[model samples]
Target: MNPKMSSPKVGFLYPGYAAEDDYPRLGKMVNPNVDVELIITEFNEDAHTVEALSEMGSNRRIVDGTKHLVGKGVQSVLWTSTSASFVRGLEGIKEQIATLEEQLNVPASTTALAFVRAAKAIGAKRVALAATYPEDVALLFKVLLESFDIEVIQFASKGIITAAEVGTLQKDEVGNLAVENDCPDADALFIPDTALHSAEWIEDLEEAVQKPVLTANQVSFWEALRLTGQFTPQKGLGTLFKQELPKEGELDVIKS
Candidate 1:
């Protein structure tokens, strides 16, 4: 086992209560010594539409969310919403990360950037995306990945309109989504949606697809750990965690 960091703490500015519990669960399962703090950001609407997501990820809302994490001594923070971040595109996401780092005075990233980093970490050239957003919204993630040279060989969108509905999904449904959308030519399956609970089902989903399953919540936490330099290969969290992070400057897609 890698030597644990002494009381390392990471904060997350999550949008709502859907799968927020995954962070604490991951802390316990991956490394109990690391503190995982979550501050729920308020949103006007929980819909998966672009307009709603744009509003949810606005700089004001993000800065407001950081109020609770200011004095927590967190090493890094992550905006744990894939659609919300990706909807802004790469430049927009960069602005978002800048806003986060400025407010918290720590290295910060978002779930959208996390997906790209995770894909490069595993050396996945071709990936299959299984998104829970509408086709238009999901296409933004494809664009974001392709910006980093990760090909989207197969894209599948569930067209779910609300985070609340996705939060209600159970393991079986989440597993089937991965298995069904997986492609033989793809190096990994990317599921983008922090509202869904996927940390506990990583092993089963990877087994079913016989490939890496990169879910939103899973990558979000992994990105937070990466920021703190506390990442170690852990069992049952799928191939992303098991692989070594890309060496500094290897994949310079996003400079968080």
Candidate 2:
């Protein structure tokens, strides 16, 4: 770690086939000063339904994995799987984050909630969505983003049902879907699935569409930056990371 870098330990609660290298690699690209450690949960082969994802991230499993990361001195913990986190909706997401904060004694977040904050960071009101999740899971994500005031102008997905399949999806396919689904009138384009391997694709896709592209893992890194109070804007990553959130206690502004 560089002496001048702010070394905040981050915990990632991930699902099977978790791509650990991509996250820190992406983090360094956006902010080279952070140290990210991952704690993966056990995800079964069949994760196509809300019930299955909920079971995969049950209190017992998440608490166990989260405690291990807390033991390692992480200051913030994030549940990095969109399906596992959003299967419960916004309120459920809130409950899970609260649980992690209480059990691990650290600030916590999930990929879905991270997306909400990420969109707000960039001052985005209308967004286009892309996903690799099953239809039900993707709809849940859409509903949650809407709760955070993001209007879904357009939507598309690959319909990948399994965690393994989502993990193996090609970068080209992800970027293509984003470009195709993104609306010209939308303020930003969002791909809210952590399993989609989006770190390498976000920059190019943003250029292809000429708009801000947000992926679940990218927003996770962005949200971690905010929680740590390190808000330096970086270029070429995306509009969200390149802009700061509104100041504390300011009235929220509405976009037309």
Candidate 3:
């Protein structure tokens, strides 16, 4: 007889700028019991500007993206757009999540929301930020984090508008961003944007910042694990992966 399959599938409503950017990293980071699936949404903007990412989170667009993943049997779905969800305001972000759960009929989340969960998991009250997003977009992300009662001790937005440019950032550059932007009061440093590859530099960046390092792709993927109840520590992925939480808990998608 063939061996039984026990993997729990999780869906990602990935924005276009992050098109196919995080799957490999996720696959490497998750346990064998968790399966990763992607459903690319309509995001025409190549830039990480507030206007561009915000448009991508329209109810019509995000709902349209989940159909395929829903059919794939995902236990939970995550809107993997970080900046887009918080670009406008928290109320819009709340409605976006409500619409997702209502339409998809499953636990739903977003990278912006996941950052909060990841921070809470590590008990980080104050976090610093480093981002490839423009100054305004980065500030919006900070606002969302602050809504969760997480303090923004320091922030450095690269003011780079395009994901194409962010995608081209070097490891040393991200490491530098982490160190340069981190504040002594911060318990963690967050690097938002799945478009910029941080999975490869997480450990090194954490060492540079001397605090836990959370990134877009890493937190979103880790959120999937929590939503699906796949509570396994991912070795070598950084402190976020090593978060020690209760063995079981409700999915940290959206409360409102």
Candidate 4:
């Protein structure tokens, strides 16, 4: 067993209308240690307008939010919003990470980047995706993932347009989407919004599809584990988290 030291503390910067239950589940999966704090932001609800999507106060607000957690001695911070991370474009996500790292002087990454990094870390050259966004938004996400050399093997969008509705979606609906859109050749599957709670359904989805089922929440959790150099096979979450920790000679993707 890994040494039972105090687990790392992480702060999650949530965009408007995000699920409140996710951070605790992440702490439970990390197990025995690691604090997870939710830092929610105030913003408009509709996801259709550029003003709402751009979220004027977002960039600085996230930095200030994370700094609050860092002051509490949190080891790392993650911005856990898909629309805000992706809608502004991939470079925008990079800029967000840059902003947080500069403020807290700690390692930081956005959920959008974490998703891409996790896919590559697992050697997922071909991947299937299930999104709750509309077709146009889903296509933008597809383009983002493709930039990382992970091919989109199959995709299906739920056509949900509002941020609030996305947060309230049922777990069974997400599980069904994972099962239906899975592709035989895909190395892994991804569900791409932190607002949508998917931590509870990943294992079942992996079993049905026979591949690593990664959700936005799952990868964000995984990235925090990497930041703290903690990797243990966690049951009840999914294949990705259930993966054994790397030994001395093994290629550690989390480190690399």
Model 3 lDDT per residue over 1-256, tens place? 0125477778888876543556656665655645678877887677776667778888888888876765677878888878888885778878888888888788777888888888878888888888878788888888888877899988888898777677788888877787888898889988998777876677888778778999988888787766775556767679988756643452253556
Candidate with top TM-score is 1
Instruction: Give the TM-score of each candidate.
Output: 0.96, 0.90, 0.90, 0.88
As for candidate 4, its clashing pairs are 7-34
lDDT per residue for candidate 1 within 69-121, as digits (tens), equals 98999999999899999999888899999999999899899999999888888
Candidate 3 structure, TM-score to reference:
0.90
Residue-level lDDT of model 2, residues 150-231, one tens digit each, is: 8988877667777777776687877678877889999998887777777776778888899888888888877666676555
Candidate with the larger lDDT of 3 and 4:
3
Which one wins on lDDT?
1
Clashes of each: 0, 0, 0, 1
Instruction: Please tell me which model should have the higher TM-score, number 1 or number 3.
Output: 1
Q: Which ten residues in a row have the lowest lDDT in candidate 1?
A: 1-10
